[model samples]
Target: MTRTYRIAAIPGDGIGAEVVGAGQKVLQALAKLDGGFTLDITGFDWGSERYRRTGAFMPGEGTDVLRSFDAILFGAVGAPDLPDHLSLWGLRLQICQTLDQYANVRPARMLPGITSPLRNVEAGDLDWVIVRENSEGEYSGQGGRSHRGLGCEVATEVSIFTRVGIERIMRFAFELARSRPRKRLTVVTKSNAQRHGMVLWDEIASEIASEFPDVVWDRMLVDAMTVRMTMDPGSLDVIVATNLHADILSDLAAALSGSIGLAPTANLNPERSAPSMFEPIHGSAFDITGKGTANPIATFWSAAMMLEHLGETAAAERLMRAIERVTADAENHSPDLGGSATTEEITSATIRAIGLNAT
Candidate 1:
């Protein structure tokens, strides 16, 4: 029996459409190569443009519509005219929170033919997977504006941390660390400054560390963690942090690895009760919207993660190797990686690489 997976692709805005189109091409190629399984993809037009036209990012029943799919392959979401918060919360956060996608996983590493900003860093030296608390903490949308449109206006965006949210993400990070060869995990937080929420994070992480004794764990203030990420890239393996903190650090990690264009993120529903969402960490590059130069490697890698989440590990591994192979060759590189190939060119090169490797 041939297995089929239904995927909801949301190419939110700007270059998102281009990069996601590239990812879908690679996925279709993979399906052809692996005849045992097939992918049924449906794209959703839900982002800034949709908001501007319909006053809604997605249809009113968007959640229900998405629930039927096995997984979601997402692209960057944002537009210059739309407020960042409005665009973000309207689509991405709404889906993640509503679906209980609590574990946000981001992998940052040096690609084959890319140069890291850090000198002497090579292929494996800066490889690290950051596990973020996705559903809650910092980005809970818990606060309000008391005196809006007034001279004395005050706005407060509260950070919320729950024991369950903290424990689950911590456990996920520890397990990930245990799976890696180093078996080391770095917990980043600002417990010293924000003593209340951050202290609880430390407490929960401390309690959970005992469960995975084999995984060596340590703590670092989020500030110091930045310096460590740059100075001692090899020392870190798996990292766990709050939603906002990890979100910031992962971008830094991406830039250090190569370019933000090459970083992929997985917003996972670990229990599999609902579909998880996969996307590149880079935002929709409005400046390069139709320039034919947006890098699609991140989206392709994101599809690879989506494949792994769907239990198509072999196909996922092949797709990743194909990406690495294409990236390894200067002729197939994109502008973001210091090469001049356009988006379609790189996409073709990647697909060709996958086909050649299969043979």
Candidate 2:
């Protein structure tokens, strides 16, 4: 029997639309190759443009609309004209919080034929999966402002941490680490400076560490951890951090591997309760909005992750092999990966690598 998975594609803002289109093309090609399952993609036009037109980034019933889908393939989300916070909180974070997507998993590894900025780093040397506490912590939206536009304006963006939130994410990270080959985990926090929330993270992490005896774990302050990632990336394996810290570190992780264009993130619910969201770690590049230069590998990789989450593991592995085949050829790569191929060229090459003609 052929299984059909419903996918909600939200190509929010700028280069998002372009990359999402590319991901859909690759998935379609994959479906053509393997007749075991099918993908039904429904695109949502909800972003800065929609906000400009309708005064809301997404409809008020957005969560209700998205709940039916098996998974979500997201493109980058940002705009030059709109405030970053408005677009972010209005869409991405809203979905994550509402759906209880607590695990933001980002994989940073040097793909085959891609050069790392770090010296003498091989393909297997700098592979790490960063697990971010997605639904809460610093991004819990527990802050306020007083006396705006005045000499004494005070703004407070409170970082909220709950026992439930901390423990679950810690256990998730530990389980992930235990599943991997190295069975190692790095917990990042600024507990020295942040005595309350970060300290609590450390405490919970320590408590959870005992449960996963097979997995070796360590803690690092967020600042020093940055240096460690750059200087000694090979030493790390699975990294777990707060929402804000992981957000910053993952971008650095992406860049260190080669380009932000090569990294994919999964905003996962992990309990099969609601739809998980997958997207490129890189943000919407306004500079490359209309240009055909935006690299589509990240989105392609993201699509693969979505497939794996949907339980189409064979299809996901095949799709990844297709991407690797395309990326291995210098002539088929994008400018970000030190080649000059356009997005369309990369997409077509990937399709060809999948043993199909782009239709």
Candidate 3:
């Protein structure tokens, strides 16, 4: 009675293929080691290269094709020659919005061997899981440009905030906060300026906070929140923000921890009606495309998150322990982490580390 989990792997563009390959290899090793379950992974050649060939990143049937899988392991998106918005909308956003994968979860922490850019921060000083409202908010894709090339051309990209969307994500964030040891959550908003939607976010957060008296929570302006993230990293536990703000903050969190190469994100539906997509937040770096210097840690971490989402908690923990083992050695650091190890080199080390564990 071995459990078989179907996974969709999308190595979107540039170094995407390299890191995704690394993740698949390590995951294969884990599957072989565990022997209790199986990963039936399907790889899709849908990305910038495909866009260049067909004017679309994925086909019309791509979303429906992915519905049967248990989870998705995404590499990266963005291409040197293709427009970022096109690549984003065509593939990633299409899958997310279509499937209602509305909760974007990004966890950042200082791994053992990595040195933080923050002056005195260490491992425990910066551990934060940012829960972003994924489906709507600034990224709701609601506006358009009226005049293409006119000097007085008008354009508007609307930010949508529904009470339904806000409440669900806030409740999700509070539950996540309750699960963490600190039992603290910060609701990020720009209510003072954007009084309408953002104010609703504040009201809903307060309403949600009342439901969880055991959980300590507060609201912060997005601007001041950024300063707090840097200056007082330890004080924060779990953070919940709108789409655009969390997008910016998570990148900064990655840099402060060590590198964007170490950041992983999970776009979840939470209801489990649709397959969740897990990916590294780092965009494609064409400069490192063929050089093998792309760090695979983020992809590996993303794979670990996917494993956890699939109820393979044991295997997921095993994968993360292996990652920490590799990151604990500076000699295993990729170029992004200021060492010269190639992607394959680091992957090999991670696989070997995975083999060392008894479980």
lDDT of 3 by residue, 1-359 (tens): 78999999999888888999889999988998999898899999999889889988999999999999999988878887777899999999999999999999999999879999899886898999999999999999999998789998999999999999999999999999999999999999999999999999999999999999999998899999989989999999899999999999999999989999999999998999999999999988888889989999999999999988988999999999999999999999988888999999999999998988644
Compute the lDDT for candidate 2.
0.91
Predicted candidate 1 versus true structure: per-residue lDDT over 52-169, tens digit per residue? 9999998889988999999999998899988998999999999999999999999999988899989988778899999999988999999888777999999999999989889999
Alpha-carbon runs more than 4 Å astray in model 3 = none
Runs in model 1 deviating more than 4 A are none
As for candidate 3, its clashing pairs are none
Looking at candidate 3, what is the lDDT of residue 169? 99
- True-structure Cα RMSD, model 1: 0.8
Q: Quote model 2's TM-score.
A: 0.98
Using lDDT, give the best candidate's number.
1
lDDT of 2 at 128: 97
Give the TM-score (vs. native) of candidate 1.
0.99
For residues 294-314, could you state the per-residue lDDT of candidate 2 as single tens digits? 999999999999988888898
